[model samples]
Target chain A: MTSYHSINFAQKISKLDELWSPRVISEMNEYQFKAVRIQGDFIWHDHPETDEAFIVLQGRLRIDFRDGAVLIEAGEMFVVPKGVEHKPFAEEEVHLLLIEPRGTLNTGHAGGSRTKPNDLWL
Target chain B: MTSYHSINFAQKISKLDELWSPRVISEMNEYQFKAVRIQGDFIWHDHPETDEAFIVLQGRLRIDFRDGAVLIEAGEMFVVPKGVEHKPFAEEEVHLLLIEPRGTLNTGHAGGSRTKPNDLWL
Candidate 1:
C-alpha cells in the first residue's frame, strides 16, 4: 500500500495529448517534476523567486533570452535562473521534464491564455 | 561570457571512469542536477532534512527499504523521501541523474569511507 511508485518519462509523455500543458509526474520535497510536449513558441515570462530546471527527453528546445538563446536537445538539461525573461521555441515536437517548486506557474509573469494549471498530475 | 551551458547526460556520463561518483551537471536554486554511474551495492543511509530525487538515465536501479523496495528503470524516476533509511543496488551498471540540495551527501548519514566529496562537476 505504499504510495511510492516509479515513473517512466517516455511512457508517461507518450500518453499525453496536449501541447505546452505540463502534467505533474512526481515530486521530491517542495519540488514537483512535470512533463510537457511543445511545438512553436511560448510567451516570454519571468519567475522572480525560483530557478527552473528543464531536462529534454525528446527533440530540441530553443530558449530565447533578451540577449541570446540556448538550444537544449534530448538527454540534455538547462537551468533558467530566477528573474530572467525568456521564451521557448521548438521547431519540432519536444518532450521535457521540468523540475521546480510545487506552486510554480507555467506562464510565470505573463499569465494569460497560455497559463495552465500547475497541479495536474499525469 | 555566460556560464550557462546545456548538459548532455549520455555524453557526459560516457566520459566518467569511476563508479558511484556523481558529477554536477547543472543547478537550479539550491538544488543540483548530477550524473553518476553506479553498480553493485551502496551503503544504507538517510538524509534527515532533504528528499532525494533519482532519475535513471540508462539501466535499472533497485532501492531497498526496511519494509519494502522499489525498482527503477531507464527513463524512469523515483523520489526517496527525507529521513528514510534506504540502500541502492544495481545488477549492472546504472546511469542516474540525481537531484538534491547543494549540500547533500550521497552517502547521507552513513558517512565513512564510502562518503565522497559532493561538489564534483562534469
Candidate 2:
C-alpha cells in the first residue's frame, strides 16, 4: 500500500534553521520544490540555464533586478526569468517555496560562501 | 524599461470564474503555474508524462487514490506522482495553484468532457 502524505509548507519551513538554505520537500519529474527561510540581502546572480520561481509563504520578499524590482508578499509569487541578473531581499525573515530544476544552485553562477548545497532534502 | 510585477494568487484567482478550468498565471521554464477554482468530484486520470502539483490556496482538498487518499488544507501542497491514478474532491469551493509542465491536460489521457483546454492564460 502506498502511503499518501501532504507536504505542509509551514511544518516543513519550521525545520529549516538556516537562512537562504533551501531544503527539498518534493519533486515533480526533474523539477524540485524547496522550502527556504530567508532574510537580509542575497547576491546578484542569474540562472543562465533555467527560470526560477518564488512563492512567498510568510512575510514579504523583494527581488531586485537590474532595471526594476518586484515585491512579493504572503500569498504572492514571482518568477525571475532565466539569464536575468537579480537579487532577493527581505526586511524580515520570510518563508518561501522555490521551484526550479534539480541541480540548480541558489547563487547560480555567482558561487560564493553564501551558496547552499543543492538537493539537500528535508 | 522592464516591468516587474508580482503575481498575487488571490487577485489571479478572482479572475477565474469557472471551476476546474485552470488559467495560467506564471511560468518558470517549461512549467506553468495555473490558478483554478474547483468544487465537487473530479475524474480519475493519470499523467503518464509528468507529475502534477497541487497547492491549496483556500479550503480543504482531498485527492482519492485507488487505495487511499491525501487531505490537503490551505497553505499545504501535494504532488501526485506520474502515472498514478487519482481523483480530487472538495466539499466546498477550493482555490488551487497547479504546477505542471506546459501543455499538460487536466484530465491527462482521460479524454472526456471534463478535459479542459490547455494553455489557457489569465
Candidate 3:
C-alpha cells in the first residue's frame, strides 16, 4: 500500500532541499501536485477558500491546527480543509507533494510568514 | 513528460474494460487521483459544487461543453469547472482518472444515465 509503481519516493527526495520549492509530478486541468523537501519549522498559515492535501513521500511532517494537530508520515496523507488555521513543522527534512486548485494561496488568514508563489517546477 | 516513474499506463489498460471504474494511483489528503478505463459514450452531467479534472492516460476522450467541446489525448489533461455541462465520448476505449473532492458526484446537473458510487478500488 505504501509503495507505488516505479515511484521512487526516495529518488524524489534526492532531487531537492529547499523548504517550499515544488516540482511538478503531473497536471490535471490547472491544478498540479508537486513534490517538495521541508525541514525545521514553517510559517503559520491556512487557505481560506481552498482545501489542501499533503502526501508524505519520506520522513515526517506535522500540521498544527488551532485546536488539534495531525501527524503525517511516508505513505500517509492529510487534508487541511478551507479556512482552517494551521502551521506545518518538521524535525527533519520531509518530502511531500501538495494537491489543490490552481492559483490557491499558501497562506490563509495568517500570511506574513508562510505565503508561497505557485508553479515553480523542479 | 508522458511517462511516470514505475507508473505503468499500458499495464493499467490491460487490467480492465468496463467504463468509469477508477483505480487508485496515489492519495493526497482525502482525495485521490485514480486511473480508469473508459469508452463509447457517457451520460450528460455536471458537478454543481465541485470541479472535476480528467487526465487522458491512453486513447482519445472528448468533453462536450455547453457551447464548445474540448478534446483530450494521452498525456493531456482537462478540468471541468463546477456547474459546467459536459458529456464524455470516446471513439474507442479510453483510459483516464478523475481528481476531485472525495465525495464529488460524477454527474453534475444531469444524473441517472451516470452517477457512479465512490471508493471502488480497481
- Chain A only: list TM-scores of all candidates: 0.95, 0.98, 0.81
TM-score of structure candidate 1: 0.95
Candidate 3 residue lDDT tens string, B3-109: 11223445655676567766665554556667677778878887787677776656888877767787787645567767777888899988875787666666655
Give the per-residue Cα lDDT of candidate 3 at A117.
65
How does candidate 1 score on lDDT?
A: 0.91
Q: After superposition, how far is residue A103 of candidate 3 from its true place, in Å?
A: 7.8
lDDT of 1 by residue, B1-122 (tens): 34346888999999889999988888899898888999999999999998999999899999998888999999899999899999999999999999999989989888998888888898
- Encode model 2's per-residue lDDT on A1-122: one tens digit a residue: 56788999999999988899999999999999999999999999999999999999999999999898999999999998899999999999999999999999999999999998999999
Please give, for residues B45-84, the per-residue lDDT of candidate 2 as tens digits.
9999999999999999999999999999999999998999
Give stretches of model 2 more than 4 Å off: none
Clashing pairs in model 2, backbone N/Cα/C closer than 3 A: none
Q: Chain A only: give the TM-score of model 3.
A: 0.81
Q: Give each prediction's DockQ, rounded to 2 decimals.
A: 0.63, 0.80, 0.06
Say which candidate scores most in DockQ: 2
Residue B89: error of model 3 in Å? Answer: 0.7
Q: For candidate 2, what is the lDDT? A: 0.95
| Tens digits of lDDT, candidate 3, A1-122 | 12112223345557776676666655554567677888887777777777787867678788887777777876455667677777888998888867776666655556574566666655
- Top-lDDT candidate index: 2
Q: Residue pairs in steric clash, candidate 1?
A: none
Q: What is the lDDT ranking, best to worst?
A: 2, 1, 3
